[model samples]
Target: MIQNNLEKYTIQLPKKLNFVLKKIDSNSNGIVFITNLENKLIGSLSDGDIRRGMMKNQVTKYVNINSKYINKKPFFLNYNSDVKKILSYLESKKNKKKYKCIPLVDNKKVIQDISTIESLRKYPIINLKIDNSEINNVIDAMKSGWISSAGSFVSQFEENFSKYLGGGYSITTTSGTTALELALKSLQIGLGDEVILPNLSFAASINSIINVGAKPVVVDVNPKTWTIDCNRILEKISSKTKAIMPVHIYGQPCEMDKIKKIAKSKNIYIVEDAAEALGATYKNAKIGLHGDCSCFSFYANKTITTGEGGMVVFKKKKYFKLANQIKNHGMSRKKFYFHETVGSNYRMTNIQAAIGISQLKKIKSLILSRRRIFQYYNKRLRKFNYINLLPENNWSTNSYWLYTILIKNLGTKKREKLIKNLLKKGIETRPAFYPFNSMNIYKKYCSGSYKFSEKIANNSISLPSTSISHYDQDLIIDILIKEINKLI
Candidate 1:
């Protein structure tokens, strides 16, 4: 029987360990993790736990055969215990269950389980704040007749974008998808080449690679940041590996510093799929600064919107020229109607740029507004008895385009029901992006069991994150709590 108060050690259940492992399926090793309420890992449960529980019939047959079972007995180790002692304890626990790891109860515990999937499962669902004041600037630009993509507003938008990233040349494109294609084409990465990316990103990123006749080597994500694990890149790297596209997912920036070094060592190109990350920075350097070419999305739901637009930024002057020409349908010299390269029409209209320019000017305020909403929701929703707030660290600035929250103990089916209930109350909520590996078109290209992705995918829902009002927040929160309580 489990003791309420463990003397030598205090055995406590993890708040998010199960959730984390659900996001990143156990590797072949079959080890599960445990973390505290703050998301700090306390210990691990091993395959042995599963085997023992099954042998003893401690777990229900209907329960997943793969799931780990925690021993009711308190497992404890002193904080001062060394690695060897910790290993000994784990070995001692080994039996028919074949458990290989035991987690420490406290920070001082000898072996805290940091290896579990739960330790890495939390990510912040942000609210990308919009600047209300920038609206006036855009209105002024519009009234001044600078309402097209080619006007001074476009230049201002590009200038502001570049300045935000410490000075990179920015070329506006019509959409995020087109922006990626523009980047790939400008970098000369096409047929006979392979571009490696995450199966977790928006399909647009993958589609861009395929559009250029380049094969996409899709890999799973880290389940922590929901970004591609850099280690996996080498396994897929080949002579045909022309570029590595690490998508900055869910307002979290990819580990660009390490990715850059690896790409350099392999002599491959790095393309920043910053479509979801407009104001996000990496090591205070900003995202687009690292890639050979970087892309941003200005879709309605993005950090900023020009209704339907995107931009490609780069340091290379040649790409700027190529992108400009390519976005203009391959026209170089108007007099001779010179077509320098085969390209398509992917230009953002001046009208879109005009709005974008206005939006850009108001980015800081918008970010702050989103942050405010995030803090409020984080503070309020997290206090609930049956909810788990996704985690976010300060490594990168998250522009919360959508606010995500994990409904504790509820599966996807239940989450769907919750969404239905919220909809009835006029409260809008969304699910995080579906696992890309599950998509029919990309299944063949996907490798590995996206256990973590599948698990979180089931229980998670995104809340409305529009920069509205505190009143809206309170109403949504009240409705959500009421609906969830009824179900819980």
Candidate 2:
């Protein structure tokens, strides 16, 4: 929640000058909003305003603030107003240093929340999950003067990560994309091979396939799960099909049992893109165990972070060895600096792995926090018929990575408008990743019907989740309800 920044600070009217003085002095940015009986914003008072008013009244800090002290017409922006105009207005006020934080209000003059550069800096779309432990480890690693790929922490991270994902062996890589690239290369899937994947995923999934020179076969996703339709995957397989890359989108695991069965029968390899689904499970078993190789991301926003790292977890020691060689310039294990085949330098650094180890220790708590946040949002969002929140189906446990939702009857443009409205209130949000077929750069790689994926992409919104203030989430939901009612 980034609690130290005082994001929810507010002052009530009829408050005395003593309190106002203390508040303005103690507030994070030397300012406070003055609200009326209904919590409706009436004005604001700054530290300078308090001092000047005290001088004019010839009174101590005991006098009431509303008695000719408050700026009753303090600058504010409507929730649905253009964000550029609000920021421009704030920029103009910044020179005075009078309005470091601006209040955003609804038409009813209720202060939804205050927007401050400091508070905004404190919290972001997906706040970095690092803490003091990770920081200390990073510092210690630097002191040891071993910040490169070849350090003890890298091996430790891989071993611990493999154990965490259920007794598998793991190889660390520079990024999630390379993890997928290494996994595919280990499977010997390239050029003449085809890999089927859902369209409702980040471009990294498709890019990995293309980088390995394997043709990407796109399939539609189930609207409910927002994952590849298991029924659709089997139909996409051809004699050239070598593997299936099922993405665990937005923390929800795909129908792995069904996909695994089909892949097993066809002798096709399975590569699970569990990048966003760390700590999630399918039927009480962790997802990484279901595929031949499961790839995870440690991007800053993921459930855990290594700043910029990824992992390839596999059940077989042989597959781990293959991935290791592929990422290490295809060098033979017995020969020093001897290359056996073509490969890439995709090794993850010890510094990143050090952070990953610290972050991983808190993965359970982090995932639980996200799920609790989802529960908080779901209880409120479900009352609205027009909104549909993501579900934790019986077959899988969701990590609630993004806590996304779909707005009924709202196309891409209106959903965009909705996002803009939220942004105007300084609440960050994101749209669903567009279907691969819809993205022009990847269009040539995708040739399939993606009606459901396209629809979900257009109508969905990834709400503010992660470690966030419930008070802030309440404000966000309130503002959302208000703006959505306007649209209706």
Candidate 3:
């Protein structure tokens, strides 16, 4: 039988100070713990607290000081308490202060030394099976000794994915970013070309544009769905604009029909960055099917897990052959060292393809699960007056890869306070990405108003979104509510 009762522990508030010094001497300057006189239930300290405390004291060197910060109170809860209840308690504190990991304390005010919500919750580990699939399908290819890149599974997987997404031809690559690069290269979009996309997207999108020697024309995302505005693209398009790579972000499809219409009118190519939008549809067609070429990621964190893999899907056979050559060092025929064009090595292994096959079969179930989780958050968090959930458009159904929120008038102090409070109660949270223009690398490249993106960068939060149980979900909502309630 399983037990969920509170245990007793103690913390010697005095010994914790000495322990901090000992840890520092062992070259572990940042590590901190909590204990009682008998090393029972006391709270924990951290390296951050030590540094700040020393800095406040004007002590540059490590000298023993009897400041209360050394025995500072840590966020903690009884092991048996309802996780949501503890999270609520932490949220109350976080909306007002700054902190890191909270401790898990039992009854008798004893600290358990455990610091992370993942550790406290003890989430199940996903067993990674690299190459365990039906290998018999390739038995004939193996017998013929054509194992390198001519495996049946690769062709079959590509064919199946292409058919599934509608008449597109699938061209596999070693990674998703490379697929983007190949797609751009196949269209002859390079150097003098400029492609438009949203500022709030993965770094891979930017890297792919650069890889093809093109300039990325970043624009602010729509405040509602965090996607590039289809209408906004018209103003940015010029004779120098060769193509537009619209990212289907967070598993939500961009307004592809509108984007396609604009591209067609302007006689420009369209490449769909479907890395995060696999299985997402726009106007009854998949995003991949709507563009000249669409790229998909098969990383472990993606909807489908293939260790590290990617693919580019398009309608034309000509583009498929060009992509194939682009991925294999710009060579067309085997056994001949003749180079047709400049290319790089970006081929996915048979082993990765094997895993991808199984994952692809499970894609429908995975998307449904993620959508259901998103609905749960929507239902619960909708009650908060200050928080705005992501908006849905009539053109597409969101796969909702990540449940995000924007807090109205949430400043840095309040945001940090809320995070600290949530952490103290054994809850985890991550802030939204800073604006692309604000980043050091793109300050010179980007030129325009980004007030919308900047607002989200400061107010947005990415809640826990692993494909798992809702055990921590309720706790997160409760904590968020408590923090927001305090501000009101």
Candidate 4:
């Protein structure tokens, strides 16, 4: 079905019933399409058809192709048919039998290829939904010769994104990693300083700390929320501790009140890795508003994207000004080319910011789309007793960046097998991030056992959470259940 050699599933019309049966047995599915001498599709035959023919006649193997066993009016689609049309035929109510494999034919009814459920489209873990606005803005920015960081869109994006998070100062960066590094540099958290963060997070969170000459103190995450365990913070804290970087994993906001109280009491900073939680909230307040510095990623897979960009928001103007200066090589604003402090090039291009502005205009709908996808997965997967759904606490609103679930009693090997089997069926899945301390490079940071983080990393699978249609979601769910059942 995926434009390969489909010869095994095709046979000449003059072939005997026994030959057709052999072809059906040899093919991946239990079916074969019959073609004439001109290679024009004439009919189709299945194992069941041969069985019925044998039951009706004693000498079925000797029966020729003109018998009643072959289905003459087989369902198919034209080669030019689009994905929507193919999906319509597959989901058509008129067909009593759910079609698993449909032949794609030329205008003259010659079998050009085959279309299986998987061939309809390769459903990715994340699909970017780009409309005309983004394209036009990028074109406009290019035409205006302001494609670099000096253009107006950069400041506009910063202002718009800051206002989106309830009034704060924002600085655009080349990536979320740079934003985190900039935030640390602006806060003067470097050299002998230590940053406490969850072990179960993307590498960027801890990498930023290490990049800024700070030591990373890895702690485990809460089993239910999959967020940094608030109770573990104090135990890992030391006199050199300068900040507690809490990652809002998979778009679920961390328990900010508890983290805030801890940071306030210890006289430490709260730098939020809100890269995956753009519109997420805690206690009805947006996530970026709670921390001293909150960083967001605008990667292609995020809720809103600028292709390869990030933003860092600050609660104080001094930090914002320092970050702005540092983001552009620490050049003094008043005196051109006068260096104030050593800094790196971490500026977001105007073209990327133009795309960001367009994406921001549709942020609300994008957030809603992600929530709708989470709800769909929740409603369906809740019936399965073996599944643990993604957390959405009563006090917080999850952006549901990726709809993740954990299978009870499933181990790492079995989960990997499940992911592989899903891939074979054209569904993509992501395993949870391996605990930081589990890696040899971060072993020096390992202080305590990370039982919960390891457990989640072993059993959790993040499904496709982009703007996929309900039909695609149904397919993913069905294949996932079948594969998970087979593996577990």
**TM-score top scorer:** 4
Q: Is candidate 2 or candidate 3 better by TM-score?
A: 2
**lDDT by residue for model 3 (1-488), tens:** 01111221222344445555565444332445555455454444556667677777743333333455555455565644544554444444534543333455555555544433332442111212223343443344456565566666677779878877877889888788988998999888999999887787788898788878899888887777678877678989989998888888777688777888999999998898998788888887766888898999987667676667899997788988888887888886765677898888888766556667767776787778778778888888888788888778787887656667888888656777776666655455667767779888877557777878778777877666654446556756767788767864
Best by lDDT: 4
> Sorted on lDDT, highest at the top, how do the candidates line up?
4, 2, 1, 3
Off-target runs (Cα >4 Å) in candidate 4 are 1-114, 117-119
Quote the lDDT for 155 in model 3: 78
TM-score of 1: 0.69
lDDT of 2 by residue, 85-160 (tens): 4455566653443457777676678876566653332224675655589989999889888889888899999989
247, model 1: CA deviation in Å?
Answer: 1.4
lDDT to native, each model:
0.70, 0.81, 0.70, 0.86
Runs with alpha carbons beyond 4 Å of true place in candidate 1: 1-149, 333-336, 384-386, 485-488
How many residue pairs clash per model? 18, 1, 20, 0
Worst 10 residues of 3 by lDDT: 1-10
Q: Per-residue lDDT for 1-488 in model 1, tens only?
A: 01111111222353344443343243444554444455344554554665686697665533332335663343555432343444444454533332333444445343322211121111112323334555565677678775655577677778888987788899988899999999999998899999999867778999999999899998767766767778788888988999999888767788787788989999999998999887877777777888788899988788788878999998888888888888777887564577888888887776677778778767887777777887789888877867766557677767665677777678767777888777655456777677777779878667776676665566778886754456557757877888888876
Off by over 4 Å in 3: 1-150, 411-426, 483-488
Error of 1 at 208 (Å): 1.2
